[model samples]
Target: MEIYSSLGIQAGISIFSHIFFIGITFYALQAFRLDQLFKKGRTIQIQLIYILLSIAIGSSVSNFILDISNWSKQLPYIFT
Candidate 1:
């Protein structure tokens, strides 16, 4: 029962973090003159790859932190 609860909490936190990271990324990209760079085919491809990689990294980091937090909460003594 406790394990299930911990898993649920960790999932929720990871989801929230992913959404937040995506939102920030979207806004940052929009604020920049990315469209101008995208006018060139090569530049556009590079930019797309960069954005995808950034999002992937962000999600991975968020999931890792959420898992660590969940583990710490489940075993507070070890984390402390």
Candidate 2:
């Protein structure tokens, strides 16, 4: 029961972290003028690309943060 509770909490944290970072990535992406790199008038396609890119970058960053956190929590075991 305790393990299941811990797992649920971790899952919730992971989901929240991914969503938060993805939003940040999307906002940051707005500063780029991607029109020069794609066909003109392909607004829908460009938006889709932005979504995919944001997920890619955001998930990577979130994973890195989570891994670092998990590692830090385990550091004390190295001396034992």
- Candidate maximizing lDDT: 2
Q: Give the Å error, residue 79, model 2.
A: 1.0
Measured on C-alpha atoms, candidate 1 has an lDDT of 0.71
Expressed as tens digits, the lDDT of each residue in 1-80 for candidate 1 is 99999789867877899878766665565656655656566776867855885687677767777678768778968756
**Model 1, residue 72: displacement in angstroms?**
7.3
Question: What ranges in model 2 sit over 4 Å off?
Answer: none
TM-score of each: 0.56, 0.97
Off by over 4 Å in 1: 40-54, 60-80
lDDT string, candidate 2, 1-80, tens digits = 99999999999999999999999999999999887799989999999989999999999999999999999999999999
Report the error of model 2 at residue 71, Å.
Answer: 0.4
In Å, residue 28's CA in model 1 sits off its true spot by: 1.4
TM-score, candidate 2, is: 0.97
